[model samples]
Target: MAAAEVSHKDLETGPPTGSEKHTNGVGSKVKAHRTKDAQHGDKDLLQNVFIGAIDAGTTSSRFLILDGAGTPVAQHQIELDQSYPRPGWHEHDPQQLIDSVRECMEKATADFTSKGHDVSDIRAIGITNQRETTLVWDTETGEPLHPAIAWPDTRTQALVRELKEREGADELRELCGLPLSTYPSAVKLVWLLRNVDAVREAYEAGRLSFGTVDTWLLYHLNGGLEEKSNVTDATNASRTMFMNLHTLEYDDKLLDFFNLDRNKLRLPKIVPSSSPDAFGKVSEGSLRGVRITGCLGDQSAAMVGQKAFTPGSAKNTYGTGCFLLYNVGEEPVISKHGLLATVAYHFGRDKKPVYALEGSIAVAGSGVKFLMNNLGFVEQSHEITDLAATVEDNGGCVFVTAFSGLFAPYWIDDAKGTIFGITQHTTQGHIARATLEATCFQTKAILDAMAKDSGQPLAELAVDGGMSASDLCMQTQADIINIPVVRPAMRETTSLGAAFAAGFAVGIWKEFHELESINQKGRTVFEPDISEKKSAKMFKKWSKAVEMCRGWSDEDEDDASDQE
Candidate 1:
């Protein structure tokens, strides 16, 4: 079938086409409908066909219900409780993750029904979650053996250093497209096996199951122990350091490097990001009986949501951290410039999977949070942009926001947060502006590295997430990077991407081109407002700051050693 060409107004107000029909899972024709209310006009009209997206992110769990047009009709979100028992450790209660998702689904569904919609209209559900956060569980009891080791946790930093010295350590990147770093699931899994008794005992008893956040959500959402839907998509699996980049499967050699036994430990089955039956159905909840058809890591989902299907299309998400993913087409391009190669998405079992080069920054919105919570510059994160706008410019100040350490392109593990060119004239506004510019500088670095690796210059950058909501921040990003920054009016592209995947599986939208008008209505484009030479000069000063900031943490470590 040819892709549909619907207008944004038509999609929002009425069906795509008159009497347009699509078949659901059971092969029954589902027609779009619009009923008018005497009091509310088109407000009571229902699409009658919908998709649900379960977005289990790092800080929160969100459920969004989208119509065929990709507009989020109803949604609910809940912040997750985070635990940090040690200095470099971060964890989450496994049950809280599950409960949060369930509550979101229930509440979102309630909101949908209250809008004069039917629950039966929701055909399929998709899931997108935080990548690389490791979870281990007892297979028999289906209880988590340990607290979920969060992706940002640095407890494995010492372990990573030790592993880098081991033989065959240098060869891992060629196989898995990831370096021996503290981010991947393999390192976190190894840490748990060595440090946690419950995890080790479960592993020894042949009852341990290892999974990322996506797999953990799938297992419980599909009826927990009864269904045991232990599976992960390629996008999430690619971040684990266990999955082979070429074959998209777990490698035995990679397993040997981590001293993992595939026989004893239960690994989630790897599946395509968009599949009709691979992920199984939602066994219970407000979404009970709906087939769970799509899954992707949050970044990958954002790429899909932005409709960045063409090669050379790139996106930058400014959340707690910043992730820049550049699409490299079907074949994976192993980065020679410190970027990680990852699966972009796999729509079906037969179709070839697309790949991307990813560059991650350790801090973006967190830098804003630090300014709010740590420095007391503002009452909320969004206010930082206003504070930044008070200053005409950075006033010769540069803030290297390496709260934990720099990541991607630089990978400077020993660097600490530093403010360079700070003078007595530096005010709170100057500091706030410099903090925002820190993310922009890192994004420019990653984009440069991506161009070097893929041999493709980015024409523009599509951006979303919490930090992207600020016009000043995005405008600064455009000025620094010298590229057009595109932000859609519907900023929940992560959830929309999951809905797109589920919609694809159920024939609601047959091809990517059908999504041409989905969320393209009211987009704000930030052009490069500054001169190119000025942007370059500003970046050069930032580069100098990065180099000077190195070894700051190393000096602190040395002082601690001397005291000991």
Candidate 2:
């Protein structure tokens, strides 16, 4: 049978009724870009099926289509607009996020067909998203009660402190594999229930729906309230502070600790990262009717994309935030250190959940964004390296990027961003160099802690995400860590991970080793070029900066003390 031709205009679709509308930015219709110039083949294209992945990230929404061999056939991305209403608070228009996903999927699928591939060959769709970003909406009206609370938002710090004071509050670490911090969804949800009038009313009326980005996209992609496609993968659910790490289900004690009335809010069902039926089918757009068979948090997806399935293997993703995951096999290790114990992946109910110790850095690529938008140092993010290249090094400068406080190893909540060793010789280049070096320094710190936590020194660190594109940054990472830094030819591992999960469900890829050859044609390895003494000296300077940055938030504490 011949494949049907799809018009670009036919890709535009409407949102759920009563949902907020979005203004089209690029074009009125979904656009297409051919991945290859090959002619159509006469064989049954269904046998040569492709898989799709939706990477709903903090900064952008991306859609990727991959063939059986894990080669990308089509790709499209649209940057998302995030609003910071106040310092340390971030938000996104939930409806706009859903709209962006639909647009990217439509455009990328159109591109797949333009390359002479069959869109019908897209067997299933997978989702990988920014974890811990919380959202709530009206179940009946399909309308968000408040803006989506971003993962980096720190509005609930006071609440976290109050919870910390409560007896047995620390017990939650063992239960949920997370500390009582503002980063978890449980605290964010509590803040919303108690503060937001709309959320409060919805809670009282029992109409509120809560989820991370994965659940939000899954809910709407499965036709919102109509299809009741409210589900989240185990990987995404693990960050919620509600799920029991042992059972992979919401625990009653966890709920009671947060004082959440489960009857008032609807929690999405926890399913495997890759499932045959749970995620449901895409209701509308160019790739309409495609089943969403897999879902994962962005970091877990990157680990899978890098094929870091074996124990002791690790990878770090440098996105809006930086996340390093050290795979710890099937058993969850409750972190004694300030790291997080999280589910790496869950193949299915029959298989045990893979676990990892995670170190999260709040500012990474956003440090570059600050230089671009806030300081006017550059117009584009990639231009940051050029500015940094002007300087020999950080010029004896150190930047401790604690925009939302620090995470992992040093859980310093009282610290803010600080720049040290500024003099008459300071320039934008020095600051840019310091900014990029801050990330590398933090990566070294996390790896140090990972080595202690796992009892295994990292052989090499596999890297991905936007900032990993900078060779200067990678070399600096290698130099500071004194370990080789590795990156793939294609840095879109987050999206590829989702595609791998979806493809696995449909039998496109049989085993983990089968994906070993995907995108292996060209791999870049940055070996450590600096002596250990020099690396230690550089890291010591960074450590001094971090130490000095602490207690900067004490003024706020003093103001609160005065009120008392």
lDDT of 1: 0.81
515-543: candidate 2 lDDT, tens digit per residue: 66665645566667668999999999899
**Candidate 1 lDDT over residue span 386-483, tens digit each:** 67777788899999987667889898766778998889999998999899899999999999999899887899898888777666777679888988
Distance (Å) between predicted and true CA of 6, model 2?
A: 31
Instruction: Give lDDT for model 2.
Output: 0.80
**What TM-score does candidate 2 get on C-alpha atoms?**
0.90
Where is model 2 poorest over a 10-residue stretch in terms of lDDT? 1-10
TM-score to native of every candidate shown:
0.90, 0.90
> Each prediction's Cα lDDT score?
0.81, 0.80
